[model samples]
Target chain A: MTITVDRKIYSDKCISNAIYWLSEKYIIERKLDGDIETISVNDDNGENFRTEFLRRLNDFKLREIIETETKDIKTILYAKAFGDFEE
Target chain B: MKKYALLPFNFTQIDGKDVLINELGDMIIAEEGTAQKIVNRTLNDEELYKTLVAKFFISEQLLPPLIDIYAARLRMKKGFMDDKTALHIFVLTLRCNQNCTYCQATSREENAAKCSMSIDDMVNAVKLMFKSPSKHLTMEFQGGEPSLEYELIKTGITKAEEINVAEKRKITYVLCTNCRNLSDELLQLCLKYNVQISTSLDGPDFIHNQNRGKADSYQKTIAGIAKARKILGNDAVAALMTTSELSLNYPKEIVDEYIKQGFNGMFLRALNPYGLASENENWQKYNDRFIAFYKTALDYIIELNKHGTFFREEYATIILRKILTPYTTGFVDLQSPAGIVNSVLIYNYDGYVYASDESRMLAEKGNFTFRLGKISDKYEDIVSGKKVRKISEIWSNEVLAGCSNCVVRVYCGADPVRNHSTQGDMYGFRPTSFFCKKIRQ
Candidate 1:
């Protein structure tokens, strides 16, 4: 699914801090050790737009970016660690 | 005026394709307890701006000379590793009846020239263990399956008991076994030796048998646990660990399995990617998923406690202790991937000993340098060896950019050996590290 990330995900204490927030918005999952993963957003005939975890933010630089951003997305981070990866 | 709070801070940086922690030092200008309260409290927009600006100014403002004094002073007061040597794990044997995918130690092949410890080797190792100033010396026996050499253990305990009495030292004996071979005879002997049982039972029958395929491992283990409790008569027997494929699917079922077996506690363990058997398993760890799993499972256990189930998740308990208390028993799990740890020494099936059981497994692939000393060698060789000291130091500092600023750095631990084995790099510097991903959560 095409999802957008706020630059705040890169602020200091931002990467891990995003764990609590992001999980609420997307599913949290991992593949082997250093690989980045993303998934397709799905909907039954009516579910519309909601899906499991979008994808793991792969770049370490991206992780740092998520950690360094100062903005707080208190919108309870979405996450659903359910289902298999959609390739 | 530019000022940086000598408060604890971790500075993470991304370079090239990896992340490196430029710095990590928590200096509390305030007294001890004060730092814990404000730590990890995610800074707000204004606060974040101020912190970054202050750090930037300090980099540009302070002369290098003053920062050095401040850094050194913080290290002295907070001395991260309190007891130089806290736990002494001796691999009694490496023979197993089960085929677990995450068995970090190699199985003791019956034809692989297996040799049980002699009375002398046990006595020497026990004597060496007492040399450290740690008041309570805990000697834990681990293995591919330690119970295989019951004779050596019984004799070794007699010697350790003799030495501890002679030296006026206190020691606790712990055994990490598979319980499949736990017999009535073994239980009686374990009781006689005052050895607390630490066995493994990963989930229920289907999931457990698939990961650890011993013909009657389930029934034998359940019966063994019953016998162990009958012999010990109380909360004496405990479960050891192993993570598996089935565990990933049903975190709750695993917890229920532990509860059903009436395990004293269940350690949600990590799969060692390295090992003779596990190398080809290609198991993956989901950091974010595991974190959620940990929290959910632990919170479930807590809920069970309210219903009078009285259960504890070992991983969460240890982490909670680190967060809630001062100075833990120094379980290696709590130390950061960058933290230093004089490893648990592994005395293989034969007379040879290595820095850790994992080291011995590496030898199968022709990496022979793992042998730190012989069971017949001086105890000083293992404890004070240059190689052990050097390798241990590699993890003692925060080298990962993400962990540098991790407020939870003190609570998380890094495994250099795992990173080195899996990534082919002794030092992994990103939060993406399997070790970091799990521990940080």
Candidate 2:
């Protein structure tokens, strides 16, 4: 099964993390053709890897959004908690 | 809604509700799409808006007026790191009498030579333990059978006592032993130093004997427990049980066994993947069964609690404490920064220091991946060395890929030893991690 994930929607890191998870069960292959990233799962066992892959892809994308938005705030919070802060 | 700034928080869907958890583990359960509403600034509920602001999920000002209080609470959550290696486990000896079916310690026979800790090395380990800056210190003795080496245990305690005259640290002594031979002298030493007895009792006679690999093992252990209780008082002794393959089928029976033995609580510890126990072929199936077994046992315990009987499940209590309170637990397994050198260290019989108890078990299998340094080495070099620097990278789940965004990250921890032992790396892959699966479930 082959799925094309748009790089604009999901970054390469998100796709790679999703693949790292599913790679345990399936022989996954990936190719980058410009903005569209094509992912192929060599699952001859008839298992529906696409659903699991898409679920993880969406979850990672959500996580990526959260991390990108909150990275600076988290840094400030941690710094205030542990690091020497100039008030 | 008024314009508001977001404080760092994460959300996940559970029971058709959006459960939002803040940086300090404070949670709010709301209707579906609540997280999207909050993120999109479309939330219209005035009460929820107020609640979110009060819980540090959102800031009415660009910087929350109480940001210092929020940082203090966050600091308290990770305060175990500041305590700095409070629990020092001394592996007295590896000699054993009964062979456990799932012996993770890799115990040697009773007559095995060179398996016990030497006095010189033990004294050095005790001195090293005193060097820790923690005000409260726990010196726990563990072994194939710690009671078997009575003199070594005595020496270790006496050395600590002697040093504490000036150090004046509050020290706790725990003897982790199989109660097969809690002799009168040993019980006397325990009573003198106020040492707590922590012994193993797998279950009822049939289950315990089977796991202990002896026909008369249960009888000896029960008698020993009675003797220890008679000498040391009931409250001073605590028993723990490990869930073996056979033990999983009898969760209720196990709980009943603890009640029958007059224990107020039971710790339902699963068999770890180390030593002889690692020989089990199917950990995935075993982990699933263990989870079901834990739930069944926990439900039974809760039912007992509701029926005018007070019983506690220790593991659940730890989780509940994390969820319900702002304080940190002494449980090393459930600490951020991975508990290795932060909260506990192992002084092994092999004259080497290790990261944790499980690290010493890995050593029994000829894997010294966690061997920090020799007992004779300086404490600073051992704890702050290059290996520890590498481990520090992935010790906290807050920075890990899967766990950072997890709803339960606040209630969970990172375990580098478990990762290295099971996943071949210190930074574990959480998607299929058994630890992640069990804890998240």
Candidate 3:
């Protein structure tokens, strides 16, 4: 099974994390060619593997967006809770 | 949302609805597009808007007026860290009377020599337990069968009591025994010291005997429980069950057995990858089956609750308490910073200290990854050693890759021991993590 994901649509972190989950069951090989990243895994029968991988990919993409937007607030929140900072 | 800023939060799709959880574990179930709308600042629901603000999910200003309160709640949630290590387990010995098919304790024959903690080691371990700054301390005794080594259990508690007189710390004593042969002398000691008894009972006679590897094991255990209840109060004795491959087939039967035995609830614990239990042929299939078994039992327990039976599923209660209440659960497995050194420590019979009970089981197989130090070592050195520091780096779920942005991160915890045992690494791959799959469900 081959999956080609455009670098413009998803970050490396998202794609890698999505693949990390599937690496346990499949022999996944990842290669980079310019802006396109191709991932190959041991073939499953049909649409199940692609569907599951795409679902996880989409979830990670959403998570990357959330992390990018709220990284600063999260730091501030944790610091406020644990750090000895002046109010 | 009208001119609002997002507070750090995460969401997951549950039952086709976006369930958003804030940093402090406060949750809001809203429409599917709620997360994108919140990020885009296009939320229009007034009720949800008020809820989001009230729950610390969103801020009307750069910093909410109640930011201090929010910070306080966050601090309170991680309050277990302030308590240091509260539950100290003492492994009395590895000797056992009954042979369990899926024994995690790595039990040996009753005559197994050089496996029991020495009297001097017991004294040293008790002394070491008092070093923790936790105000309330629980000294839990476990083994292949702790009751088999009556003298060690007596010495450990007596030593702890002797120290507590001057130390002035609140203390609790627990005996993790099989109840197969809880002798009269042991019951007398338990009665004298107010020791709480924790035992394991798989299910009805057939199931219990099959798992226990003894035909009369169930009878002896039931009789022992009756004697213990007669001596110690009913509330002082509790039973826990592990979902074995055979046990999964009869979830309702298991619950029914617990209720019949007069137990108010049961902990539907899963078998971990340690000791004899690690020989499981297929873990993923077993995990999937266990989850289904857990849900069936939980639903039956809930139905019983609705019908005036005061029974509860202990695991569900812990998870629900995190979601519905404003307090933290004392359960070690569900804590965010991970409960290893922060919540529980094990004093093994080998005169060594371990991070947790499972750590010692791993040691039985020559894996010393979690062995902290010797019983004679200074408390500071044992807890603050380089090994502990390395574990602390990845202890919190808030920092783990897959867990950091998880919707249930506030309620879930990290288990580096499980990670190391199952996945051969402390930084576990989360997507295929059995722990993740089980807890998330």
Q: What interface RMSD does each of the candidate structures achieve?
A: 15.9, 2.1, 1.9
Clashing pairs in 2: none
Span of ten consecutive residues with least summed lDDT in model 2 chain B:
B398-407
Model 1 TM-score, all chains together: 0.67
lDDT sort, best first: 2, 3, 1
In candidate 2 the C-alpha lDDT for residue A67 amounts to 68
Report the error of model 3 at residue B103, Å.
0.9
Q: Relative to the true structure, how large is the alpha-carbon lDDT of every model?
A: 0.56, 0.89, 0.89
| Model 1 per-residue lDDT tens digits across residues B123-184 | 66776677656666677887767777777677667777887776776678888877767767
Q: Write the per-residue lDDT of candidate 2 for residues B1-441, one digit (tens) a residue.
A: 899888878777778998888889898999988877887789999999999999988888877788788888998888887788899999999999989999999999988999999999999999999989899999999998999999999999999999999999999999998899888899999999999999999999999999999999999998988998999999998999999999999999999989998999999999998989888999989999999999999999999999988899999999988877898887889888788999999999999999999999999999998999999999998899898888888899878977776779989999999988888888888877889889888
Worst 10 residues of 1 chain B by lDDT: B16-25
Q: TM-score order of candidates, best first?
A: 2, 3, 1
Misplaced by over 4 Å in model 2 are: A44-48, A85-87
TM-score of chain A of 1: 0.22
Count of backbone clashes for each model? 43, 0, 1
**Which stretches of candidate 1 lie above 4 Å from their native place?**
A1-87, B1-6, B10-80, B109-112, B118-120, B285-296, B305-308, B336-343, B399-402
